[model samples]
Target: MAIKLEKVVETFYQKLEEGKIMGKKCTKCGAVEFPPVYACNSCGCWDMEWVEISGKAKMHSIVMPAPLSTKPEYKNLGKYAYGEIELEEGSRFNGVVRGMTKKKRKEILAAGKLPVPCHAAIYQRDGYKTVVFDLDEE
Candidate 1:
């Protein structure tokens, strides 16, 4: 089966190509949804609006990818890990965070800094752009 790209997804990618991060904000409850959706997840409302995100976020948890489980497409990402990221606008989601190695992860965990500050970046893929996060400097 083929996956269909919804209008919201298409618009999101278009904005990424323009070097902007966009999200859907609920006009009713003032909740924002990153990775833009057509409806609001907070109040189950369909009254959503497109908003440019600040790309500021926090990584609450980190899980490194196993050596054998790494994908070829991500080989160019250097060191990365999956993490639960919370946007500054109050949206939470799991996303790939670049610049994280096992050693770095160990060091961070030892320091008891779980929810570290991170900022989003637009990564150029083979044919498209995507969002990734990098740990902020201490």
Candidate 2:
């Protein structure tokens, strides 16, 4: 089981390096799991298939990271916040969203834009790649 889990993680990063965001689609219930899992959360089905995601999502809520809780590895990200992200394929998760500053958050809230459009991006880390999102320009 552990080895299988490791393989899933490895494959996920490998796909990101190839510029493709992947997710697992449950054959049983047609639910998609982002950051691809090995089973379906909706139906307890282990029959899953890999699929490239659309890279499109909506930001449902944003929460700024506190100064003390900031991680050094994220310094290069430049003004980001954690938010509830819902992928176009129906997966919902919390993800780091770049380009969201305190002032921008205020503006978005004042203007009544609670849920905004965002797109996925693969970020290059020191020795690995990961996914992040960018808010669509107003």
Candidate 3:
């Protein structure tokens, strides 16, 4: 039998390569897991299937990267921040959201907007590509 975690990662990448954003949907209960998992998080079911995601999400909060604390690994991920993200499928997570600046974060907060529409976008890295989300318009 394959390692559950490893299999989940493998399947996720395979789908991404095909330009399809896939997630795991539990058969035991109607729960969707992004960054797909082997077992259901909601009901602890092992019967899950690869389901395409709509790529729609929202930014519930923003946490700007600290100044003067640069990581060589992130030299390429220009202007990013760690923020709370929620998929339209109902999964919530914290991820790197690029193109976020301190001023922009404050501006967004000042507008009294905590959660804003966002969509998944593929980001190129030195080793492999990954996904990030972009703020959407009303």
Candidate 4:
């Protein structure tokens, strides 16, 4: 099981390198878990399979990073903030959103667009592949 779990994580990174966002689809309940897990979070099912997410999501809230709390590894990630993001496939998760400045985020809030459109994209970190979201213009 440990080796299989490692394979799952490895496959996730491999897909990210190819610019495709992958998730795990539960064979039992048909639910999908983004940031893919070895088993189904929705139904505790072990028969999950690889699935590609649509990269479409909605942003519900934003919290800019604190200057004192910023991590060195994230310094290269310009102007990103954390937010509650919901995927089009129906999964909800908190994720980092790139390109969102304080002013832009305020504009989104003032415009009454709390749940603005967002989409997932991969980023090449120093030692790993990571995913982040951005405003979904479409």
Q: Judged by TM-score, which candidate is best?
A: 2
lDDT of 1 by residue, 64-90 (tens): 999999988888999999999999999
Q: Local distance difference test, per candidate?
A: 0.92, 0.94, 0.83, 0.88
lDDT of 4 by residue, 1-83 (tens): 89998999899999888888999999999988988888888889999889999999999889999989877887888998999
Q: Better model by TM-score, 1 or 4?
A: 1
Question: Taking the tens digit of each residue's C-alpha lDDT, what string does model 2 give over 67-117?
Answer: 999988899999999999999999999999999999999999898898999
Model 4: lowest-lDDT 10 consecutive positions:
129-138
Q: List the residue pairs that clash in candidate 1.
A: none
Q: Which stretches of candidate 3 lie over 4 Å from their true place?
A: none
Kindly state the number of residue pairs that clash in model 2: 0
What's the TM-score of every candidate structure?
A: 0.95, 0.98, 0.90, 0.92
Q: Candidate 1, after superposition: displacement of residue 93 in Å? A: 0.6
Clashes of 4: 0
Off by over 4 Å in 1: 1-5
> What are the runs in model 4 whose C-alpha is more than 4 Å off?
none
Candidate 1 at 29: error in angstroms?
0.4
Answer with 1 or 2, whichever has the higher lDDT: 2
